[model samples]
Target: MILAKKKQRDFHQLSTPWNVVFNLFAGIFAFLCVFPFLFVVIISLTDEGTLAREGYRLIPSEWSFEAYKYVFQTGDTLLRSYGVTIFVTVVGTIISLLFIAFYSYAISRKSFKYRNFFSFFAFFTMLFNGGLVPTYIVVTQLLGLKDTIWSLILPLAVNAFYIMILRTFYSTSVPDAIIESGKIDGAGEFGTFIRLVLPLSLPGLATIALFSTLGYWNDWFNALLYIDNPNLVPLQSMLMRIETNLQFILQNSQNSSLGLEALRNMPQDTSRMAMVVLATGPIIFAYPFFQRYFIQGLTVGAVKE
Candidate 1:
């Protein structure tokens, strides 16, 4: 009875300090992550004149939603860009996940004759690539993907690192006994993969899917390089244009009948903040939904058996 009480006391003593330290670090990191977003939100809602008078602050001196109102005034441009981003993210993630999953599965199979050779081929691309100009020419001139949504989706559809990670996961986690059992049950190679392998690899798939979706969603480079159509511009690129180019903002502001003078007087800085918040809204919302899956997937795939 005395020993048990001592053990219990020691456990409580150890846990108390650890819990305090953990909570302290977690709170600090959480504040660091959330502070910038809070500042952005506060600035976005601040009156333009107030922002011009005083730079950004955690709390706005005068609150107003004019920037958001101005953004939604036309609404079509923003809405269209959002639609394009969504379409590309969905389509690109699906294509990338399918290709990576199939290729990884093939490479993970020990009996596959050319697995090593194919793995080397895929891995080699990561080390060296045909440089930017040639790649651009091939994608734009040869493939004729310029100015289309395909320009955004096709070029970045396959990522080498993701494939490697998935391959490692399949090789480490999946048991050879299961495959042999499936074969004994009269399942063909394709059927075994479809029924047994893919189900077990969901964590790896979820991890890669999140990576692909983020890549597709945040990508402005492909659009900047190959896409010339204003209608096909993704939200990030549109936000970039609106924020960096005063003339474009002025032109957009003109459509509201506030005139150049009033727009100049308005909180240009606050509007930039508002535009950033608007552009990132979808990602902010979608991230939490996939976050649990992402964490689980990465943990499983990263562990070697």
Candidate 2:
């Protein structure tokens, strides 16, 4: 009884300090990650004149919705961009997940004859690619996808790294016995994959979906390269235009009679922060839904037998 008590004491002594240290580190890390975003939110609500006079503050001297007012002064364009971004993100994510999951599942199956060949082909893409100029020519000239939504979706539909990760997850997480059972039950190949395999791979699929959603939502370069129509502009591209126009007006403030008046009314600083808030706010809400699956998918994929 005495020895048992001493052992318990030793464990408690060791665990207590380690637990304290771990919590301390985690708390600090969480604060570091969250503080920048909090700062942005605070600045977005801060009065522009007060911000200019005092610089950034965690708690502002005054609050104003003027930045948001300026942003939505022409609400139609902002609303249209939101519609475009939402459509692209949703459609792009669905298409990407379908192609990626199907391709990854095919190569993960041992019975598939060309699995090794196809796996190598997918992996080979990671090592090399056609130059950007050639890709642009193919996308624009040959395919004639330029100035269309397909240009945004098709080019980024499949990422080599995501394919490899999903393949690894399938290899490790999916049981051969289950697949065999589906076959023994007289299920067809497509039926088995659709009903059994896909259902079993929800965590992996959700993880990849989150990645694709973020990629599609955050993409501006694709629009810049392929789209010329303002009506087709996504939120990021619209924000980019606002940023550039603001810069131009500020830089040439001394060159024109109207420059000073433009600068006076621009909402230059707070509006930039407001744009960031607008662009990122909805996507932040999505992270919580995917958080569990993301952790599970990453952990399962990381440990390969």
Candidate 3:
């Protein structure tokens, strides 16, 4: 009893000063991570004249909603592009996750006859490619996926690095005993994969899902290459077009003495800040959901039986 009470007392000395120092360091680091977003939000709200005069600040001299208002002016076009972006992000992430998981699992199986060949096939693409022109031909001429939503998805569905990551994940995290147990239960290949393998592989799946979601969300190059129809352009592409048009208008407005300064004093700098916030806000929230699995995925293979 005396030893037990003494051990309890030893643990209650506030640990050490290092704990305080580490907490302080972490608090500062966290603030630094969040500061940029807060700064952008502030800049977006700053009055154009005040912003130009005083520059960016934690506390602006004046505030206005002009930047957000400018962004939302074309409501119908904004909503349509948002729909396209949402569809592409959701469907594309799902497709990429499925293909990646399936391919990785198949190749990870020791019983797979062509595991070496399939592994080589995925790895070889990491070092070499068919080039842009050939890929364009395949996408546009062969696949006939141009201007369709599938164009956004199919091109990015198979990533060599992602395949390798998940394949390694499967080999290390899933013990062979699990597979034997599934077989003993009379589960077929697909059934075992869906019911047993997948549940055990959530960490890897969520990690890949987060990556694929971000890739699809930020993909404007795909839209630029494949989508000619304005209606099909994703949100990032629409924002790029808006910036291009804004530049054009600003340049042409320069011909008139009061043109750039007029037009309700449009906030160009602040508008760009607003664009960043809008484009990134939804996706920023997605990270928290995947963070638990992402950490687990990264730390996989650290231990062995």
CA lDDT of every candidate: 0.85, 0.91, 0.90
234-260: candidate 2 lDDT, tens digit per residue = 999998988898899999999987998
Clashing pairs in 1: 48-267
Count of backbone clashes for each model?
A: 1, 0, 0
Worst 10 residues of 3 by lDDT: 256-265
Across residues 77-131, which tens digit of lDDT does each residue of candidate 3 receive? 8889889989988998998999999999999999999999999999999999999
Residue 55 C-alpha lDDT in model 2? 97
Q: What is the lDDT for 7 in model 3?
A: 89
Provide the lDDT at 293 for model 3: 86
Q: Which runs of model 1 end up more than 4 angstroms from their true locations? A: 1-21, 247-263, 298-305
Give the RMSD in angstroms, all C-alphas superposed, for model 3: 2.9
For residue 8, give model 3's deviation from the true position in Å: 11
Ranking by TM-score: 3, 2, 1
Among residues 3 or more apart in sequence or in different chains, the pairs in candidate 3 whose N, CA or C atoms overlap within 3 Å are none
The numbered model that scores best in TM-score is 3
Q: lDDT per residue, candidate 1, 101-134, as tens digits?
A: 9999999898999999999999999999999999
